[model samples]
Target: SSAVTKNTKIVLNLESLGSLPADEAGPLARYASTIQAQRHDYNGKVLSIRAEDLKSLAIIYDMSPDELTTRLIEWGVLSPGADVASYFDDE
Candidate 1:
């Protein structure tokens, strides 16, 4: 007798709902709803989070503001094409 391992991948889509396995989908949808409920609108952009919002997100992600900022830059969410040095000058 041979045993086979089954693996399932869940991809979340923000634009529209897609077919998802019921067992896993319900929890994911609830989690997404929670996040959506906490979201703040920024200049008409629902997804653009402000620095003040970072306090809550940092607590959730267990990170400091500096760490979160670094991660955001690495993730290409902040300062996508700007040079870091330009933001700071040698004293």
Candidate 2:
């Protein structure tokens, strides 16, 4: 039997996040600070977010994880198609 692998992480580009407006970048930077250990510098290409982090970050934006992912893409925090790890149930 074959098992499917579910992706539970999303990678972000710090430089891109830094370029955003203060109001937008503030929350991301604050969240990034808390996940120092999870952070990858040269980096999952940038900020590597786990499932838990994804949920938490969504809270900061008053969004659901799905919405946050879209917003992240819009903010350039996440690269359009390449950076995202498809969100799947953590179970």
Best by lDDT, which number?
Answer: 2
TM-score, one value per model = 0.37, 0.70
Candidate 1, residues 1-91: lDDT per residue as tens digits? 1111111111224333224444533443445556567764222222433334545555656776556546545544445333322222221
In candidate 2, the residue pairs with backbone N, CA or C atoms under 3 Å apart (3 or more residues apart, or in different chains) clash, namely 40-43
- Note each model's CA RMSD in angstroms: 16.3, 4.1
Off by over 4 Å in 2: 1-5, 37-45, 82-91
Best by TM-score: 2
Model 1 TM-score on a 0 to 1 scale? 0.37
Worst 10 residues of 1 by lDDT: 1-10
Question: What tens-digit string does per-residue lDDT give for candidate 2 at 1-91?
Answer: 2122244357778788767888877988877766765444444447666777777777888987778888888887776764333453333
lDDT of 1: 0.41
Q: Where does model 1 exceed 4 Å of error?
A: 1-46, 80-91
